[model samples]
Target: MEIRNPIPPFSLETALEKVQLAEDAWNSQDPIRVSLAYTIDTEWRNRSEFINGRENVVKFLSSKWQRELNYKLKKELWAFTGNRIAVRFEYEFHDIQGQWFRAYGNENWEFDDNGLMRRRFACINDLAIKEQERHIV
Candidate 1:
């Protein structure tokens, strides 16, 4: 696995960098690449589903992109303390049938010493919108 840089105990700049790195990684929609940012035994609660370990994380992300076609995401750093960070994000995607939707969410992340995420909890809700309502493509 490629070791991620900017290991935690983050300064304002590093925290912002972390958030942007996460946004960039997710935007790539590469499940394995994204999963490597987390610990091998990482734990996650994404909405109602509970995911444990890096392998499951890959599976979850793969399923997500399958349903959320052409996904585009933006993430903002909400706060950071110690090795933990909170983020607010919005993502635009269409279903396989091409019904547009925007999802707004918050994620709380805890990272290990190596900067690999150890835990992540997210709460998200989606709103249906017309194509014209979409601000991000």
Candidate 2:
């Protein structure tokens, strides 16, 4: 029964805070740390993959970071309502061979009363970029 603080019925300030916190967590590239922000049975649609439960989330993120090296992410608050939020985000990452990419996406999230995200839907597109073209700053 962990309450993730800044729970539900989000105001503009709270919504922004939530989005910033999420961005920080993802940028950390720690699957276990990020998974804790979601509920035990959290559901997610990341790119074309559909994942359910926190365990799956951790596995998915672990696999992702392993493949996508030097990951950096930025998330912006798009909209919000009671227990729900929408975000637009961009992230930069490279592969083991150092092929760089920038990914742009949107996510819709629904949180439980405890403020742990129970559902997340994301749509993303990745663009190949030269290593010099990338500015993850």
Candidate 3:
């Protein structure tokens, strides 16, 4: 049982802590590092793609970071109760050609008793933006 700490049945403070931790991990852009926060059999729905298991999480993140260069992410806790949390987030990134984009979205996460996220569903939209228009720098 690998516990990630701040185990569920979250309070406002712990939920906020969890959100911040996720934001920091994502900003690092290290797929393997980020995948550790989820369960071995975690499931996800990001945008239109459906992914299952930690292996796929790593693969998905690797592909994402490769195309989304210099990515920076910010996540805010929206609501929480028991083993679930909801968040609204925004992230900024650029492509290989230096075209910048900002993505805005919401995510619902369900955690296992051990504190690893067992499920995640995200709704995100990306908009083309000039570098100067970036909110996350």
Model 1 lDDT tens row, 27-127: 99999989999999999999999999999999999999999999999999999998999999999999988899999999999998889999999999999
Q: Predictions ranked by lDDT, top down?
A: 3, 2, 1
Instruction: Please give the CA lDDT of all the candidate structures.
Output: 0.93, 0.94, 0.95
What digit string (tens of lDDT, one per residue) describes model 2 on residues 18-135? Answer: 9999999999999999999999999999988999999999999999999999999989899999999999999999999989999999999999998999999999999999988986
Supply the global lDDT for candidate 1.
0.93
Q: Report model 1's TM-score to 2 decimal places.
A: 0.97
The 10 consecutive residues of candidate 3 with the worst lDDT sum are 1-10
Can you give the lDDT of residue 71 in candidate 1?
Answer: 96
Per-residue lDDT of model 3, residues 1-137, tens digit only: 69997999999999999999999999999999999999999999999999999999999999999999999999999999999999999999999999999999999999999899999999999999999999987
TM-score of each: 0.97, 0.98, 0.98
Q: How close is candidate 3 to the true structure, as a TM-score?
A: 0.98
When sorted by TM-score, best at the front, the candidate numbers are: 3, 2, 1
Winner by lDDT: 3
What's the CA error at residue 15 for candidate 2, in Å? 0.4
What RMSD, rounded to one decimal, does every model reach? Answer: 1.2, 0.7, 0.5
